[model samples]
Target chain A: MRSVQIPISDETIRSLEVGEPVALSGVMITGRDAAHKWMVDTFIKKTRQPEGDDQQVYAALKPILAGGVIYHCGPVVAGLDTKDYRFVAAGPTTSSREEPYQGDVMRHFNVKGVIGKGGMGPKTLAACQEAPGAYLHAIGGAASLIAQSVKRVLGVHKLDFGVPEAMWVIEVQDFPVVVTMDAHGRSQHAVIEAQSKSALEKLLAA
Target chain B: MQDLTEPILELVRLTSTDLPADVEQALRQAVEREAPGSAARGALETILKNVALSRANSTPICQDTGTPLFYVRHPAGWSTRSLRAQIESAVAQATAHAYLRPNSVDSLSGKNSGNNLGGHYFPTIHFEEVEGEALVIELMLKGGGCENVGAQYSLPHSQLGAGRDLAGVRKVVLDAVHQAQGQGCAPGILGVAIGGDRGSSYYASKEALLRKLDEPNPDESLAALEARLTQEANQLGIGPMGFGGETTVLDAKITHLNRLPASYFVSVSYMCWAYRRRKMVWKDGQVSYS
Candidate 1:
């Protein structure tokens, strides 16, 4: 198996090949359904006032504090400021939950990398191609131990949404993630499902 | 008969934020067993690790602190004043102590129930009358990601294409799981409830999930179906986290109702890797661990 560390960058993300297992290391932001909605409303859609100016947003259902990786996690977080704590349960909601808002967030935030348990839907791929960004699929249900690897939780924002669904800003190093969908419009999720179905048909015939 | 309001509430509190002793032990052992894939195995290890962190630091195991779902089977013919309130109070108490992240959000107003209370969507409790004098409660922290994958379908009675047979039901379930893909977090447990009306099917599915992983299905046909589904689903190669490989489903469970010629409804619920659920059986005057 080929393993390589890719730095978080807009152009690098645009060139990723399909089905390439990637280990991501770089600054990544955490945003989920609530946060995604917030970003769109506040920024692009302008339904809600802008929280901040242009930046890269990760479609993370949870966030981990480790060396320098952005986990696609939206953890159930409690507390505020430095005292924040995350539990290792199902904080990572479905990545599809943010399908409608991902493309907008990428454009508005200038996000280079996105980490989540599941890859995003079609709109996201279109956006990724137009922008400098990629969707990395991390193994789902690895929340608890993954939290332990979080070297340091840089800071947390948006406590108003409650911990389980809050938008967290965390930093990590050498975080494990696979490049499922890259900026060049390649998607591993679609490829694998097709392959798996065909393989199952063969097994059934055999 | 004693008023179980306070005690039941206490049990709810303890189970929600704290991993009961048996659950803790069981989880620790599961990690040691070490599921196949590095990621699946790693996920279980993290669960055990989180239990340690939670127990030591008194942090809630997961932030979802989900809707405190309780399955309580108490003595038959026993009735009390305001059972729901008592349970709610217990959830509130446990939520406070567990340091559970406030997850209950007011649907109409879209505001967080700051104390993890007040929301209609949380602390979902189901009650049943059983042959015992005491109350047995199974508390599950049902996170939204996993909960979203739950499916309830009404299949018209027939054979072949006429009705929902094994193949038809299998197709629905397979599609349900496949549609869920990585969203519900695979390598998960699927709770299937068949042969009931809409509401009963839903309840039956949830009840089926309470069965222990190793316990054999009571009905031979359903049990056989359960085993078959488990094998078939894993064969889908959904694997842990839906990445690929074997070990897609940890277990599959089925519970059914003896139905007439009416429509058959099948409901499926998905439990993600961190299946945080515990049981407490009441005994004597003192509340003890399960």
Candidate 2:
């Protein structure tokens, strides 16, 4: 298994091959449906100016995301009352949900990789091809095991986005993932879909 | 009825943290079928480890502790009004205890309920009055990932040569499994409702998930269909997390309801491998969980 640290270089990211096991160890930001939509609508599309603390939030996020990983996760969190957030259970949410904004988010932020489940669509694969990035597939529902990899909680933003949807900056060690979509424009999900479609047709005929 | 709030809280904890034995067995079997060092096997290994750790540590098995859906069956005189409140209270406690994620959000306001308590639909409690003295409450944590891939089909459709027969049902069901292609988190369990109105069909399909993974359907025809669907779905090669390997679906459950003459709706509910569900039974003035 390959080990990946944060502030990964483009060359390092591009070197990741599809189906290879990777143990990601570093800082990553957790974001989901609401966070993705908020990022796209506010910063990428510039529909509205960053309101209140969002301007500062954006400035803080830019450097971290430049060569970092964005995890598609809505984790079950602990320490809500004390505001000392820790992930009790953190697993990948379905990545396909972010297809609409992932490509643009990657380009805009220079994100080196995405850690998620179920892989992604052509848009993200294309984004990986254009830049040095890969889409890593985490084990779905392996929440507690995955949470064990989180060494510490760095911080969080967007409390208004709900606990799960909040952008949590966490430091992780030996977080496991499979590269399902690579910088070479190969998407394991797409390949499997094509194969499954053929099998479905055969079953229907039979 | 006595206060079921505390009992319901325990139910939520068990459902969230403990992997049912049968589901765990199916996953173990799946791991054996995949080649050594394969991504599919590795995923299953990680899942199993997570399941064990969650149970031992009393943490949620999945981060998306999911929507807490309670199916309540009470004796004739038992009050549903009280049951609903108790269930909600328990759900809130579960969220606070970290057995459940804060899942409910105000659709219009774009705000979370924070405690997993939203409007009526949240902690969705469906109550039915039964003849027995025992009160049974079952909870299924329906995760959003699998819920998104659920499909409904109106039969006698022209597109796939699917008619309003069992054969057509097989075709459409296969189509759903194929389209899911590990997006719903294969190896998945499919709960299929063959006939009913749009609402009941979908409801019954999800209800079918409460059945044990290895239990045979009472209806012979439905049992056969269920077995065949599971077999054919696995053939799709949409293995664990869609990396394309041996197993896709661990089981397929089939249930049927009589429909009006005009409508032939078949609803499919896909459950991810986690498959969190548990029940609490109150009988002889004692409460027990399974």
lDDT by residue for model 1 (A1-206), tens:
33334344554565666555565444444667676777677657877554442243333322231112234455644334348554333334567877898777666656566677667788988877877677776655445445554555555566566655555655444555667787777786776577667755544443
Query: Which residues of candidate 2, in runs, are more than 4 Å off?
Result: none
> What lDDT tens digits, residue by residue, belong to model 1 across residues B1-290?
66666676556545545665544454455445444545446555545666666666555555555667878777766553356667766666555554455667777767777566784446676778888566677777776778887887667423223246766676566656766665676667788887877778877787787777778987898788888887787777766566565656667888878655767777888877556677777766767644
lDDT of 1 at B77: 60
TM-score of 2: 0.99
Q: Pick the candidate with the highest TM-score.
A: 2
Q: Model 2: per-residue lDDT, tens digit, A1-206?
A: 88989978988998999889999988899988998998999999988777888888888889889999999999888998998878899999999889999999999999999999988898999999886789999999999999999988899999889998999999999999899899999988888889889988899889
TM-score of each: 0.81, 0.99
Write down the C-alpha DockQ for each prediction. Answer: 0.35, 0.90
Task: Say which candidate scores most in lDDT.
Answer: 2
Which 10-residue window of candidate 1 chain B scores lowest in summed lDDT?
Answer: B154-163
